[model samples]
Every structure is written in structure tokens, then in C-alpha cells.
Target: MLSIPTFPETDHQIVRSLASYSDRELVSLHQLHPEQGKFFAALFCRYGAIVHSVVQHAVESQLQADYLFAIAWRQIFGELHRVKLAADPEATNWQNWLIDITGNTIAQIEVPPSAQIRYTLNTAPPPLWCYLERGLDLLPPLSRLIVVMTQSLKWKDRRISAYLQGEGQQIPPDSIPNYLIAGYQQLEAAVPQDIREIYQSGIGKQADALN
Candidate 1:
């Protein structure tokens, strides 16, 4: 039996739903509350690379994509209500508002005439396998699943909590990072390659080789 996910509505529909809220509710929720910023950040953290992909696809160079992605998030937090929001208010359409800003920013900004294109290997190196292993061991057995989901699979904190909760673990929001951090430490402590004894010093050396 295939279980289909139930999305409340499409992203565009979300925007429209949000748009339909009373102006007072929107103003209070978005403008007047300090906690609103935290909620917005949670959304960003949850949807990071996906939202980033939107920027990448909309722009030209990787650097430009990075820059615009950053600016979009910044604008979301800083410029809340500063610009006219979409009349449609669909989250998908609302995203287009940010996309338009990126396009417009590029149109106006000019640098001295230059023509060069270059690609570089990704600068962020993969985390050491040893460190990751150590990190995993640090977590209590029950907590390991959520920790892996967050750190490795890029699942968000709430999703991880839900997963564990479903499995009868009853994880609290505050403890998610603790599991991941401990797992990271375990991986960091992997036995050094050279010092790893395959033939065994704790046991007697192989008889024929020594003879």
C-alpha cells in the first residue's frame, strides 16, 4: 500500500491563504511580533537548499545564485512589508516577488566592463567519515535516528521530532541538537589510520612472520 503525502495545499495556495487573512492579523503576526522573526527563520532553516535552488535556477552564475539567495532570505526577514507583497499571496507567487527583486537588483547594479567565466570545485569539504561515526556513537540508541535524519538527511528539527514521537520516543525540541552534536564528536574520534593494528599487538604477533 502506497501512502501519499497530504500537503495542505500547494505553495501558491498557501500564499493565497495567507493573503486572505485579516490585515490586522497579518500586521500583528508579521509586523508587530518579535517572535514572528524566529518563526520566519525556522521556515528558512527548514527549506534552506530548496529555497536556495529557487535562487540558483533564477540567476546565472553560482556566485550570483548564492548572493541572490542570501539577499532573498535577508529581504524576507528585514523587508517584511517594506515592498508590496503579491496581491495573490500564494507562497509560490510570493516567492516570485523575491525572484523579481533579484532580477531587478542585477539589472541596476553594474561593474566595470569585464568578461570572464570560471568554475571552481566546491570549497566545502565533506565531513570526515571518522568524525561522523564517532558522532553517531555519542547519541543514545533511541535518539540516533532523529540525529541522522537532521544531520545527514537534512530533515528539519520539527520533522525529526515528529519521526521520533511517532516511534514512541517523545523527543522534545530542545534535545535535538544535543543528539547531533554528540554524534559529530564520535565521528571526530575515529582511531588514527596508522595506529590501527590489523594483526594485533594486544595479542601475540603472527608466529611465522616474526620467525
Candidate 2:
């Protein structure tokens, strides 16, 4: 049988000490002292934002993100005892494991009503718009959401961020433009060859008009 570690009567110092523990050390400590809330809290405080960001990126509604966050943490705690150390003790497998869990959590959510509506409306878009939609679909979920909101809905980055924040996501305004650029790149790369020229022409015309 594995030996479980015991905590002292005063755990406050232990909690503080956990703050400086390496990720591997933390995992080992948690495995030994599964009953200690401070160890779990320390891990959560260290990686909660990352998990939240991943969930927010994949989900549109705050409610859904909140739900996913809770599920992710619960799963993390439940599985911590089973985590195996990598050959490299310094590797960030723990964080990666959390991100993978977050992705899985997002996958369990139903497609949002807005996304469904957008898909329905685009069923018979014009040829150029058809290609645009296909390209948008090739983007990662978060990037696709950002592109649709920015280009199709004509929402400003600040507004987009605000809307996401209202839904419980914490995406900063500055990050929206980066997501847009990534979405556009995915679109450019994935657009069909036959429609590529037309797409380029349309973008060139738009650029010329702005200049």
C-alpha cells in the first residue's frame, strides 16, 4: 500500500511553502497529501487562468465557460492521483494535461444558437461568400468566432471583447486583433484554388479603396 502524507495541525505555513514548489514537487505533494485543500488551492491559483482562457476561447457564453471551468477543475482533482511523471522532471506536462482537459470539456458543449443561425443563413451564400465561409470554418473555434463577429457582424474588437466578457470570458481587447489575423491566415490558406483568384481580387479592391 502507498503511504499517505500527513499534514501538521497548522497548515498555513505549508500552504505558503507550496507556493514555491516546482510543478513536479507540487504534484508529488498533492499525491501524498490529497486531503490538503491548500495544495489544491495552490495548483488552482497557479493554473486557473490558463484553464479559463482555454475554455473561454472555445466557448461563447459565460455560463458555458463557467460550467466548463468547474468541470475541468473537478476532473483535474480527480485525476491528480493518477498523473505519471515524465522522464524530464522539468517538462510542463501537467499544464498541457490541464489544457487537454479544457479542450475536451469544450467539446462536450452544444453548438451555440448564434453559430447555428450563422450556419443556417450561410447555406446559400454567394460564390465569393461561400468561399469565405469555408475559410472561416477552417479556423480554430475561437478564431472562427472572432472572424465571424468582426467581418460578418462588423463588431469592433472592443465590442467583441466586451460581449465575450459579458458572457463571462475575460478576453482582452488587444487580443482580438491577433485572433482576427490568425483567422484570416487560415482562410487565405484554405480557400479553394478555383476561387482563390476572385478572393484575392476582392481583397485587393477593398485595400485599394481604403488607400
Candidate 3:
């Protein structure tokens, strides 16, 4: 990995240049300009290793890690403007923001097929949660809606409530799990043992991807 010295006293002039540029300055520059080729290059030099470490930790496989790193790089390009303009980019704690970005990127990785992240119940069959997620497709319309919004999308209860209200049925936050649970139970009755394993593993990794 290339070493670009940390800002303030770093031999990297781009680092020094950005160190003096406020978050607003960087944001405005990005917003008011045609592109951020040079600006992003400086940031990549400054934190590329940190980002690589993050992706490597999640994927463990070199090939997959490289793929995930490429995905993160693309995200940085797409979202760079938002990050630079974020509330406190100029502060000394700027690296924290970068770390947060990298960490979020890591969480979004899909664990491979061999990994079943949740606890298994028995050798004869997989855990209950495995069947539950698979059953998601068969659930009652409103129940499936609640579970997907609350669990998969991770939306706040208030937003979910509003959405439900728009659908002409109101449900409290406390009842969300019940709806999901009932849906899962029905799904369990119908799923094959092997199918349950795959469903459970996929959802767990999907949730991890959100971490």
C-alpha cells in the first residue's frame, strides 16, 4: 500500500492542501465544479489502506475482498460530495468520518455460502429463523410489508407507521414483530429442510451487510 503521510505536517502536498480546506470549502468545490478527480485522488491516498483493511475483514477471501473494495470505491465516487459537505469534515476528527464510511462499507458485504451465521438447532434441520425469512414471500400482504420495512429496510417505526397509515391500516410498533412471527410460523410449516438453511443464511448475511 502507498503511504501518504497524515495531514498538517505530511510530505503529501495534497494532504496539506486539504487540511486547510474546510468541509464547506471541499463541499462547495465539489458542488460548484465539474468533477472531483484530484480531490478524490488525495482522499484515496490518505485512506485507501484503511478502506482495504475494512473490506478484507468482512470478506476474508482475497478475490471477494477485492470485489468489495471496488464496490466501496464506486460508492465513494458516487457519494463523495455528500461526505465532504457533511456537518464536520474540517474538524480534527475528520478521519472518524472516513472510518465510519469504511466500516459501513464492510458491514454491507455478503458472507459466502459456506457461512451460516446464526445458531443451528439440530443436525437434522436448521434453525427456525432460516425458514422464517424464506416464508417472507408467502406472508400476508400487510404483514410482509411490516416485516420487510422494519427488518430488511431498517426503517424507523414512525416512518413505518406513516406508511401503514397511508395503506389504510394502522399498526403500532409493538405489533410489528407479531406480524412477522405469524408469517414465519406459517412459512416454517411449508418449507423444505434444505431450503430453510439457505434462507436463514441469506437473511443473516443480508442483515450483516447492513451493519
In order, what is each prediction's RMSD in angstroms? 20.3, 20.3, 16.9
Q: Of 1 and 2, which scores higher on TM-score?
A: 2
lDDT of 2 by residue, 36-118 (tens): 44556556656766776676665665544544555566667667778876748676587788787767767765545432333
On a 0 to 100 scale, what is the lDDT of residue 176 in model 2?
A: 87
Give the per-residue lDDT digits (tens) of candidate 1, residues 9-104. 124332334544543345345555532222333234334455566555555555555444544554454555454444543533444555565555
TM-score of predicted structure 2: 0.43
- How does model 3 fare in lDDT? 0.51
User: In terms of lDDT, which candidate is strongest?
Assistant: 2
Count of backbone collisions in candidate 2:
1
- The lDDT-based order of candidates, best leading, equals 2, 3, 1
Lowest summed lDDT across 10 adjacent residues in model 3 is found at 119-128
- CA lDDT, every prediction? 0.42, 0.58, 0.51
Relative to the unseen true structure, what is the C-alpha lDDT of residue 3 in candidate 2, on a scale of 0 to 100? 19
TM-score of decoy 1: 0.30
Q: Report the candidate with higher lDDT, 2 versus 3.
A: 2
- Model 3 error, position 178 (Å): 59
